[model samples]
Target: MNVQSNPVTASDTNARVLSYAEAIREAMAIAMQADPTVILMGEDIGVYGGAFQVTLDLIDRFGPERVMDTPISELGGAGVAVGAALTGLKPIFEFQFSDFAMLAMEQIVNQAAKLRYMLGGEAAVPVVFRMPSGSGTGAAAQHSQSIEAWFGHVPGLKVLQPSTPEDAKGMLLAALADPDPVMIFEHKLLYKTKGHVPEGSYLTPIGKALVRRTGSDLTIVAGSIMLHRALEAAEKLATDGINVEVIDLRSIRPIDRDTILTSVRKTGKLLVVYEGVKAYGVGAEISAMVAESDAFDYLDAPILRLGAADAPVPYNPDLERASVPQVDTIEAAARRLVRREV
Candidate 1:
């Protein structure tokens, strides 16, 4: 297979609105067309067009050899992708649900993550693992977990969680270019969400955080679907005289500590909101980062994290909503923090 020596860059013209899933598919298609070395492998991604249909019609364009449909073994599929990456092919492996990654831990962590280091820079694994994560579809405890933090904790692996269609496309392209293993956690509920996406290939720099809204009263750090909720809460809080800054943490690993620290220092308060479980989640690490940094001195109040309850995601819609932080919950938490109540 042929590999494009030149990198794909952003285009200024021909921008159009597209859904999150469409943006992701567009990124993979662009990469495959540009570089024949890039291929896709996952369950039902061919005829079924993927569990969420992100890979729809890719097989028709790229053919079955490049757009392969593997059996129902995530471990086996992941292993194959890792091996392919090691052999100079860029493979995008999809996991229907992030929770299923538990079964592929040996391949992901032990093999894919450690191979480059074990080879002492002689080898590179250009594999991108896309996982549909989060707790919105009522798929129950098994399928609804937002487990990005689990992969983020590992070394030698870059973890990304894109919240918007623009970032979804940009980050995927960026991940395809990386030489090391990269894990992308795509929030399941954001699939149908629409936004303006650039027409051609673009790269959203990894390890950089985007400041969605700037404010002074408090800083709300959020990722994935929770970024949308935080923005909604920010709007409601604005009317209440609470000026809130919302930070969308696009990349989980190699987090933008400078952006987070600067925001917290300016606001004098930090509220980390996420859909992952409360204990030992991404929020905890962000809170610790600020608390351990110079930003801690600027805090007028204690750092607060609003995350999902310390329980499995419930299958019931109502129960699911309550288990995780909602718009109201985030707004109330920001209000309480500003008032020195919490």
Candidate 2:
């Protein structure tokens, strides 16, 4: 089944529509086929097909050596992946749940992030860490946190949060190509979302943002699932004469400040939305970027940020829905901003 109604064309051929998970698997397959040094290491990624089944059937294609499954210890697997990267192997490590990444902080934050800098740029750590992140699956507090901001805060590591199947496939390839360590936070709810994806290898440049919709009144900057909701909000606002511009922040770290500033400068108002908590989160940094730049002069309203409440995600579906910004909430916020009510 084609997931995208309007598939992007690559050259003269129409691109295939694929789900986010399928796109990611295709990217890994393409990379592994092209490079012998490329390897995949994660718990149950081989025989069990990974926790999310994103790595299903890879073991049969690449065999046990390249698609090696490790013990359930995230710390051990992450450390070994870093070691392999340091030794000239391109390793893609998958964490069952992003929350498990917290267990591997020492290796990711210290060793993976600082090794090249410590060695005077003499070595390259070409490692990609992929994990299922975000709330909406009733996974409760421990597993549903949107913690991309935590890694984005680090200097040397590059953090990505792709919102579409196309971006998911492209960004994964780009992450593998990078010389430094890259963290890819895949939202659990978005795994089934479909979009047009190219058949072969393609790189969606890191540190760039995509403008999902353009308008002249207010600009909405969002990442991951929030971007999708922002687009839906934009569509809803259009019927009421609120032309909202929506920017998809595909990459969290090294954010595309230029795109954001340009959009804000055009719209004269900015609303930053994220699934992460509002306090000191990704939106805070984005709001600061605009405030500190020349874009501040163009803002007709006080910059607003809509994010999840500063608390652990609850398991109850209704409570979970209330905790994070939804399409209606975004629409309400945009209307308030446009009407000069807030």
Candidate 3:
């Protein structure tokens, strides 16, 4: 994208507007400057500034050593990052696109997930993987996909999907501070989106969901770009007096069950939206969570799930848009469920 947003430094006084990429860059800079052990590893992250330019100007601020670019192999790079974490260095590895993570499943799912347990807590793997994920960029099937649910199913890894610039910076800092492996699924479409991000270092508490809008008629839960879509749908539905409540599901793996359950009980209706395919996706997990919990009794209607189409993401813009849930679709689904139409 080659956006030239100014870099965030500690000396800045007030909260400033920043793009999602700039915010992530600020978090990496802040973490690297604060801790010498913190380093960055990714393909073309140094001078090339990452595939989406999220790491732009980072190599200059921290030098090439701290912001080391690795070979083109995702598996090799991932294995090295995991080893770096075990050998007393905190490595933030960025995958050009999350779809490439499949090549490194052995390192991420096997080694990073089982080391501590296999040694009975004698060791820790504090690695952070920053992956640019989701559709809408016309990267087609090979590059456009939402795989947070894949890593979320793994026990030892923490999966986060921060939608706003504020949460993007804070949650990345939180992941850096965590003692286990963390996967941050940053949506490609959100890279240039802007929001107010506070100065200095901060941590958006891991595993906590934020109530974006409060209402009592229906509850809408989503993460990443889908969360923004849900919010937009909620706003439009508000004028019709639908009174939809929106929740930003910041952490996927360690889900904020209490927040979801509380909202479901208050609203009496639930709608889970996600960008992943309909079957075995995040929507299903959220639906099942409320269904299995005491919140089931509070449900005035059946929980509805709005997810991506089963077909691969198409290069055609119209087809790509049709494959994923959009604002209109989300609003329609929420309206139907709240009105007892299902």
For model 3, name the residue pairs that clash: none
Q: Candidate 2: where is the Cα deviation over 4 Å?
A: 1-13
Per-residue C-alpha lDDT of model 1 across residues 142-195, encoded as one tens digit per residue: 999988888889988999998888889999999998888999999988999887
User: Residue 121 lDDT in model 3?
Assistant: 99
Give the candidate order by descending TM-score. Answer: 2, 1, 3
On a 0 to 1 TM-score scale, where does candidate 3 land against the true structure?
A: 0.96
> Candidate 2 on 128-203: residue-level lDDT in tens?
9997999999988999999999998998999999888888988999999999999999999898888878778878
TM-score of each: 0.96, 0.97, 0.96
lDDT (CA) per prediction: 0.90, 0.90, 0.90
**True-structure lDDT of candidate 2:** 0.90
lDDT of 3 by residue, 1-342 (tens): 221212432224466889999999999999999999999999999999999999999999999999999999999999999999999999999999999999999999999998999999999999999989999988899999998899878999999998888889999999999999999999999999987788888888899888877898999999888888988888899899889888889999899999999999999999999998988988889998888999999999988998889899999999999999999999889888977997
